[model samples]
Target chain A: MRIEIPGEEYMVSGHLACPGCGAALSMRFALKALGGKIIVVLPACCWSIIAGPFPYSSLKVPIVHVAFETGGATGAGVKAALEMQGDTETTVVVWAGDGGTFDIGLQSLSGAAERNDDFIYVCYDNEAYMNTGMQRSSATPYLSWTTTTPANQPKENPKKDIMEIMAAHRIPYAATATIAYPEDFIRKLQQANSTRGFKFIHVLSPCPPGWRIDPELSIKISRLAVQSKIFPLYEVEGGEKYTMNFEPKGILVDEYIRLQGRFSHLSEGEIELIQENVDKEWNRLRKKAGG
Target chain B: MKKVLTGNQAVAHGVLLSRAEVISAYPITPQTTIVENLAELCADGILEAKFLRVESEHSALASIIGASMVGARTFTATSSQGLALMHEMLHWAAGSRLPIVMANVNRALGAPWNIWNDQTDSLSQRDTGWIQLYCENNQEVLDTVIQAYMIAEEVYIPVMVVLDAFFLSHTSEPVEIPEGGEVDKFLPKYHARYKCDVNDPHSFNLMVSPEYYQEFRYKIQYAMEEAKKVAKRVDDLFAKSFGRGYGPIEGHLCDDAEVILVTTGTVTSTSRGTIARMRERGVKVGLLKIKMFRPFPREEVKEALRGAQKVAVIDRNISFGCGGIFGHEIKATLCDEEKRPQVFDFVTGLGGRDVTPSLITEIIEYTCQNERPEGEIIWAGMRG
Candidate 1:
């Protein structure tokens, strides 16, 4: 399989990202796909630090680190300004974490999507608020143990289906990708860049410390998440057409969860419940994709 | 061309003449017509700008912050609760040094949800480092909105052009709409010193450690001080292009007055009428209208009030535990003066109640009869 990734390096080596950070890899692939003629609007997220501090930056492209909930609005603004300045070629992309995307930033994101504003919104989902420490966000999966949701009182609710939310807006493009699948991630970003209106790409990034996983296992865990059907890799066009990007390996949910310490306290019954939930969701997604 | 325009319509024309590249806003009372007019202007192909109709006030300000960073002349307007909602982004806009101009029509903050005129909304944003300009009429509203872009762009600070909700925003007056060519000559297209450029890629509003954060803040304050001079320069240049000028503070017969009345927004207009009537009756009263609030016009305020035996501050807004908002600022301004007037803080006409000429007469009479101010807040026209 000749999975060709761009050789051009837009991201530098001296970023402040943790070892094997999935978000860092996702940004690298995104920047590579989108190239240099782009400005990234970052809301409060792990990427805020990962993008490096003032007087220093990791990416070659310009970045504007805005307020937490302003990802969507800020992206739209950047696009509007670019259009006003007669520089419509420059793509405006918003890179945010799960907390900014699914929780705090959802309103702005929904707004931009509704307007079909010209920008690409990328949600680097590490599940919880990884920057402030492992706290539960709406994107946190069922029974996941965050710092707020301790082992005894784990997350009870299922993760919010953000893809559905994005699809509901009937935006021009919406997709799910992960760092493990570099080709798919880059392809979706390039496609999003080519399309005119508001585009959303949800990347299932893995947090090493927050997810209680070894630094080296981030990619492995991300791949397992796709194969185990816990996080499906797919795309939606104009909120209706759904396309499954990858064929899941049909790995068991326990195999995916066992490696992470966040799920260490889960009983067999809880694991079964999670498997059942994942199966149901996978079936629903397959149906949407017309099997 | 002399045309009768509401304060909101004046704002739309000012923005149009200034050639603002981007306008973003959320609908709130008294401020809605400003954006509605702009929307019509944009849709009719009269104004070459992007009108981003955002979902909330937070997004309205946030979008402009982004637009300003991208080197576009941006504007937004909101009132009361909307301004409160945009508090966080207001700091962001100023800290980033994006010269985004905003019109805040002063409406009362509410738990009972009353939407009428007051100074509390923009006053609450006083600490946010935005250069605030209060307008007394529709002409000043138009003029200030045009000058704000020049002042803000020059100092690299955001400016809030404030006006009374019903008094100025809704009230129509014959405003001299400056020719677009004249405005273009006064204020040129915004040339940002620093902006988001992919070719010369850099990061903005990034995480600054304690080592450099204070210096960044110092720069903002330093620019604020510079804004005072820039504001004056812009006003002079504006007067050159168009035949009108409004400095940070406008004094009416204050030099020889025994008692002075300090006011802001439309209250200044009402006070002007009151001053003329009192002067006719041989009562030595003056009017000092404070146009610029954020940079406070401290020195100008002190200089104007220095000769008066007593200065009565009629405030339409209170600061919760602290007396009147402007009253506290005036006292603080005069605190270090070697010889200052007996400053009386009078709170009146809160939540859209009229500040009539009779009310002004009672305030002045009370101040003249008393030797000293009894308390922090003397509620004027309180039904005992």
Candidate 2:
């Protein structure tokens, strides 16, 4: 298939992001899709380091490194201000980490979405707070190991249902994407770009250090997540309409869990329990998508 | 045309005349009226702007940031807790240098949940890289909003026009709303030199390593210092166009006064009134009204109080362990001077408590009679 992607490139090659950083790749693809006419609102996150320093930015587009939880609010303001100047063509994207999106930034994001603020809010979900050294976040999955949630007693709470929370706002568009699936991710971006009102794209990013996975297996793990129905690829329009983008192969959830060191300590029973949970979630999502 | 309007309405009219393209705000007491009026204007097509009704203060700031990124002239308003909620984005707006204008109705920060006048909320955000302007009355509120955009865009920094809650925000006074065409002539449409343009896309507000972060901070600081001159120039031009003038600090009867009262926001109005009353009673007292709080007119403040015998600072806000919020700032500004006035700090009118003229007279009288006390914060008007 000959796919004609975006002609302009906003991100440069010499970035300081860690190799196999899913968030960085997400930004790279986002810049490609949004083209040069973009303003990236970045809160405090790993991308902050990835964008390099002032006078030497990694992305070609203008970046606004804001506070940890101001991504959504700041983006809405920028968009409004741009429209005032009779320049509505430029796209304003709030690129935030899972911590910023799910926890500290939840209120702002909720406000923006509720108001139907015209902008793209992209949450690069690495599952934990990597910038501050692998601390626990609301996005952190259940039974995950981090500096805060040690191996002995992993994360007690389940990962927040961010997609559902965003979808609840009845936003114009809300979707889940991954770096492993570039074409699907890019396609979703195009769809969001075309739609008006609030658009949310939650990308499940794999962390090399935080996830304790082989640096090269980031894409493989991300793919496995979709295949095993652990992190299903789906979209919701107007909060009610749900559509599953790709059908899972119905593989055992262990296929996705065993590779990551953070989840290595899970026993057979625990794995079975996780598999049951995945199946139940898949059923619920399929039902929502009308099978 | 001159119209009798509350300080909130005057600010709203200033925003309307400024031709602001977008407004994103969440309702907070005192500041709610400003946005409510703006929303009404947008609805009535009097002000052609997009009014974004956000769910929270954070979203209000974020939405405006996005709007500003696209190069729109944006505005928003908040007070106390709402301002605190926008604390994180305040840093972002400044760091991004979006030149977004905000109206802050000064209120006390809560533990006891007070909604009265104080400078703690805005003053706490002193380091957020925004040009903070404190207005004493409705006229200043109206004029400052128009000039804030000019000064902010000139220096490429966000500006916050602060007014005391109830005193200025809810109080009514006559204000001259400048003609839109005249305002346009004075303050042209904001053309960001470094905005997010599709034609020339360049990364802004990116993360920087330690190697270059200092440079970014220095640039912000340099821009702020430059803003002081830009603020002066804009105020000068505004005066020339509107037939009125203002500065970082306004001195009232301070030339030959033995006691000077340093204050900000609407309290300055009461202080002026008290100065007149005291002057009638043979008291050599004057008033120093501080307009700009961020690029804190330190040199100007020192020069203004140079010949004064004693400087009594009456702050409407408390700094917890410290005496008065503004008092601490004033003392800090004059700390290294060769000869400083005997500074007395008095905390009063917290949580919207009244700052009547009689209280001001009594404070001045006490400061002139008693010796300066160390770390003493006399609670003005607190009856046992």
In terms of TM-score, the best-performing candidate is 1
Return the TM-score for candidate 2, rounded to 2 decimals: 0.93
Predicted complex 2: CAPRI docking category: medium
Name model 1 segments beyond 4 Å from true.
none
Distance (Å) between predicted and true CA of B299, model 1?
1.5
Model 1 chain B, TM?
0.99
A13, model 1: CA deviation in Å?
1.4
True contacts kept of 2: 0.87
Q: Score chain B of each candidate by TM-score.
A: 0.99, 0.97
lDDT of 1 at B253: 98
**Per-residue lDDT of candidate 1, residues B1-384 (tens digit):** 999999999999999999998999999998999999999999999999999999999999999899999999999999999999999999999999999999999999988788888888899899998999999999999999999999998899999999999899999999999888888888888899999998898999899999999999999999999999999998998887788999999999998999999999888888888889999999999999999998978999999998999999999999989999999999999999999789999999888989999999999999999999889899997767
Write down the lDDT of every candidate, Cα atoms only: 0.93, 0.86
User: What's the distance in Å from true for residue B73, model 1?
Assistant: 0.7
Candidate 1, residues A11-36: lDDT per residue as tens digits? 99889999989999999999999898
